[model samples]
Target: MAEIRLAIVGLGKIAHDQHLPAVAATPGISVAAVASRNATLDGVPCFLTIEALLASGVEVDAVALCTPPMGRHRLAAAALRAGKHVLLEKPPGASVAEIAPLEALARDRGLTLFATWHSRFAPAVEPARALLAEAEIRSVRVNWKEDVRHWHPGQEWIWQPGGLGVFDPGINALSIVTRILPRPLFVTEAVLEFPGNRATPIAASLRLGDAAGLEVAVEFDWRQTGPQSWDIHVDTADGALVLSGGGRHLSRDGAILHDAPEREYTEIYHRFVALIGAGASEVDLAPLVHVADAFMLGERRVVAEFHW
Candidate 1:
């Protein structure tokens, strides 16, 4: 097998918990180096900044960026300009418009640029899409709520501008929704609840629709205390479809359809390998477009301040 030497940019929780392990388990790819401002991996060459790593002439063929969405464009563009394939974590960039130029850059350089939506790689997500594609969909409701304190403890960047706040997790639901449903979706109405002390929304209520007038009601909140809830319910003319456990579990009218362990990151890595080998780029911004639309059409309400 042809090997791809990959460097990791950013050593945060997601990189350690998901990207590292996935790359280790995947074939044809291995971690050659890492760049992080605060953390380092044992036995691996680490640099303070991406530019430093690229300048050091490290033998890296690909780069996975796990940093916060803000400032990622520069890092990714740097990697591509240095002749390396790039994989971006969810929400691709801080904004929808920024991703296209990166795509064009990769195309001009003949490098792979993958804007990955990991939730779409969930075990049941494709099955739901296959099922929904054949059924007559009637309605959709997305309840994506989670405790930000437990998930993002001490992550001060989450409240900053361009951090996406609650939509950080909520966009996962939108990714699956956009993939499974047959029709294109657009936001109709949105009510965003911003914390009195933060620059982003803590909770949001959104109404989305397609050309045929199919309505999708969405609720995103970062205030749940107990078990995190990541569920999507779709009411169709055939039967109701439920994708829960962040796309890990799926049921049709209460009968289990697809349930399995989550291998989303591993699958993402495999896709990355294939794309790099084929010299192709997979950059889909539909989910991020929905997020941008919500911000554009939503009404803002200042809620109580959040602590921790």
Candidate 2:
């Protein structure tokens, strides 16, 4: 019941911008140490690797793995085996196969392993899910476009094999869609636009459907300029439901329903703490599974070169 002594594993942009601030604001939690090869947080012990952090005996109750998906599995397994709860960032692992063993390990050890989908904590997501629960669904359209240069900046690992390309942000949309809709959705057809110079796609268009013949069209692009957009439009027998601003704002029939401040990371920490207190783990792989299915079944097209 005392303050959870947490250590952050990656000191990247997301950790500095979101995780640090969220941890500071949340009660009953304190950042005890950090482990990153190239970055460090002020006033905390920094280690070059998770192995070093564990061997140093820093006495951390939990660790948040903010590293890229490529290295998440190993770091998380290490933390869990060391008798510490683990919090994984979005997409969890590079592939679906990498997550099962870690989940099993955590379950067997009686430790909490939280695969956090931060977007699910958005203000409008729950409301949208609640409303759609009673409405007869017709169709869904997701348009998630943004300029990657502005958002990613110098993040080169994004174009690598496990980087997830545009899906890095696109997965956020998928997470919300999977949560809000009443039925389970799976990819039927997909087209990926990969740059000649990169291993990942710059854009993707997917057609997803469930058993009830409900089809949803999704578009993800990293080439948008000027005005950025993250909107999901759902059409049902009742009317139109729009979730714009990345699930921060919701509207029905063009009338505002819910719009509030964003506190995704804060809520994520809260959930992590609760899970630790309850001695349980929350791991959802639907969004990541949809992504893996897309890769297995989707057709790939080579596009013009993309430069940072």
Candidate 3:
């Protein structure tokens, strides 16, 4: 098969750090151009907007969107309408209602639309999944706490109304949780703690359950001071299972079970190439759906201000 000429939209930190490098390293892929409002690539073609890029007649097979979740639907819709496959960054869209339209557009155009979740491609995650499949899960707990200033820095959009705030990282946990568990889960109750000055929450606690009465509680806080934790612990009939280091390591019975270097973006690129080659679309919004449900049904409380 011929190489897929790809263009990247929204050249932000994720594009520079993850997508760019991964595209460069992957086979059967070439980044022909980049679209960003405030940045430009040295050698590759750059455009200020997606419409401008399409209007310029830059022939490319696919476009990867790395924009914030707020206004991504229109860009994605346009890309699909223009007959270009789209690879959306995680949290696909701002709301649950937005995803169906994009999916419909992609189907109407017969183009591949991939909503990438790089975290699910983590090495240890599948291994952990295999171990947990047979065990009778008794309970599950997730502690995903980090210092937002250290992680997100001065990114102001994260606190905006549709930006997802702490869930910007929390969804990664949800993705893994949804994958590893044996059955589907739904949010029962949730509490969102928002900064007095922001529209998004700074912290969230959710209670999730399955039909079998399994209990899973998730806690996300963007105010942790030191030693950030991205840990998920599940207790089952076969001792206890621990997936730590953002699903890069696994431990059980106080012993390390599995560990490997992270190649999440590499795997994501491989999958993208394969999906494009086979004319397949991969867009799973269950994680984001749960987030939206939490937001709609959660009780909100005002908290202290957050300043970087």
Candidate 4:
């Protein structure tokens, strides 16, 4: 197929900061149209909604759904029914169940569906997987903390129901964990701290374990103040493997290993292109499942009301 004419739905910060740049850098794929409620881009047909964009007679072959997870399934289903391939942003849907029907729809239509976990494309991720494949896994630790003001700012949907709040970023860590590990991990227990004023938790701690007794400790906090921390440290029989700077840096036993420039979204689009070429779909719900499990098994505590 020729360069895929892609439409990006939702003009949030992530759309401009990540998807726009990634699509520009990747070959064999270019953004041809956009659907956003409150934003516009130069040289592209912009619509107020995805439905309007789809009906606008724009020559779009695929769409990247970057909207908040709450109602994305409707858009994905519409795109699939319209015979267009779809690329879903992280944490594909509001709930784990919303993805299966869309997956079936894509399969029925023979169109590609990608539930993207962009963090899995981090420079160190594949290499980390490769290394952990041969080593005896011991334990995993994740400390993903970032200030909402710095990252999300006034994004109110994030604090609303199904926005995933802290898990919005925490799911990225779960993505990397599910990718690198050799086996399935389940949430054993969790403690969630929800602000009295918000509908979601601002901080969370979770304990996870595999069938083989390997343990993983997770800490996700949107209330972090200083230099943000996005790190995962794993202890093996040989020592420890660390992925810091949000999987941009990798170190083994205090030795620098893979520290490549981060182009995670670029890699995502590259994989999306390949999937479309092959007429295949990539929808892995392991990360979202962990988040779901965390919520299901967590202890909720009401805290002070969060402002801004």
Candidate 5:
């Protein structure tokens, strides 16, 4: 197996908890360097900025970008222009428009540019998709709620314009929705609830539809106090299909169907390696495009001030 020399561009929580471990376990990937403003990995060469990393002659073959969506485009573009394969974390960029440019850059450079949707790689999602494909779907509902303070802590960036607030997790639900449904769905109505002191919404409610008259409703909240829920249920003619635990478990008719260890990031890394080897790009922006469309179309309601 050819080892792909990789650099991690963000040293944040997701990088620490998921990316690092997954990359360490992947067969054809190696972390050659990392770039961050104030974070570092043990024994890994660290640079203060991406430009510095590229200037250091690290001989990296690919770059994984886990930075906030706001500044991701420029970094990914630079990496592709430098003849390196690029892996972009979920919610690929701050705006859907930006991703197309990066896509073009990678195409022009003949490099791989993958928009990683780790949630779609959950073990049970494929089974759930199979189950749903056979059903006459009537309606769908998604409930993704968690405590913001517990998940994000003092991370103030999430509340900013491009931070995505509740939609950060909500898009994960959208990614699964797009993957499982037999048809494509588009947003019909949406309402975003923003804290008075914040630029992004703390919660959102969305109504989506497909050409086949399928209706789907989604609710995203970051204020759940206990027993956080990440569930998606589909009503069908045969039986009810449920994907719970953020796609980790699947159930139908109140019986467990599939359950397995979550190896989403690992699968993501493997896919990245395959894309690089094929000299192809896997760029799907439906999830992020819907997000930006929701933001553009949804009515905003200001609630109480949020502090963390």
Candidate 6:
């Protein structure tokens, strides 16, 4: 197949830091244009909005949406209607209800719609999955804490209604968990700590379990000071497995099982290409469902106000 001429929407931090570089590195993919209100790429046609890019007729075969979840549905629907393949960043939409119709629309139009969970592509994720496939899981624990000041800086939208706050990073951990576990896990109880002035939570503690009563604990916090941590520990009948560095490192019983450089976005593009070739759409809402469940069953506690 010819190179996929892709247009990138919402050229913000993730787009500049990961998407653009990944697209450049992946074969059979080319950056045809870019659409963003305040950002643009050098050497590519830039537009203020997706509608403007579609109207300008830049001839794009696909579009990657890096926009916030609030307005993602509208943009994705319009792209599908326009007959272009679509790739959505994690946490596909603000609400779980919005995803089903988009999947149906893409299927009806025979266009590829990839709801990408980039962290699931971590090098150690599959290895961990394979290891757990044989071992009987007794319990699970997830600790995903990071400093918002260091990662998000002055990105104010994160504290807004649809920003997802700490969940913006928490969902990555959930994605990996959903992928590695043999059975589905559901949120049984949750506590979300919201800043007094913010619409979203700054920290959350969750209790989850599977059908067989297997226990799982998850903690997400944005108040870490010194060293940021993204780790998942799984205890099994055989031994304990640890996935540290946000799924980049996997160890068990004091021995390193898998550790390698991160190329998650690069692998994401590869999957997008394959999905487009197969004329299929991959949209798994399990991870997002877990988030929605947490919000529904969680108790809200107002914490001290935060300011950047």
lDDT of each: 0.95, 0.95, 0.92, 0.94, 0.92, 0.95
lDDT (tens digit, per residue) of candidate 6 on 221-268: 999989998999999888899999999999998799999999999999
lDDT tens string, model 1, 1-308?
47999999999999999999999999999999999999999887899999999999789999999999999999999999999999999989999889988999999999999999999999999999989887888899999999999999989899999999999999999999999999899999999999999999999999999999999999999999888889999998878889999999999989999999999999999999999989999998999999999999999999999998
Off by over 4 Å in 2: none
- What does candidate 3's lDDT look like per residue over 38-121, in tens digits? 999998889999999999988888999999988999999999999999998998888888988988888888889899887899
> Pick by lDDT: which candidate is best?
2
lDDT of 4 by residue, 1-308 (tens): 79999999998899989999999999999999989999999999999998898888999999999999999999999999999999999989999999999999999999999999999999999999998988898889999999988899889999999999999999999999999999999999999999999999999999999999999999999989989999999999988999999999999999999999999999999999999999999999999999999999999999888898
> Better model by lDDT, 5 or 6?
6
Candidate 4, after superposition: displacement of residue 81 in Å? 0.4
User: Which pairs clash in the backbone of model 4?
Assistant: none
**Candidate 2 vs 5: which has more lDDT:** 2
Q: Where does the lowest 10-residue lDDT sum fall in candidate 6?
A: 130-139
lDDT of 3: 0.92
Colliding residue pairs in candidate 6? none
Question: Per-residue lDDT of 1-308 in model 2, one digit per residue for the tens?
Answer: 99999999989999999999999989889999999999988898999999999999789999999999997899999999999999999989999999999999999999999999999999999999999997899999999999999999989999999999999999999999999999999999999999999998999999999999999999999999999999999998989999999999999999999999999999999989899999999999999999989888989999999998
Colliding pairs, model 3: none
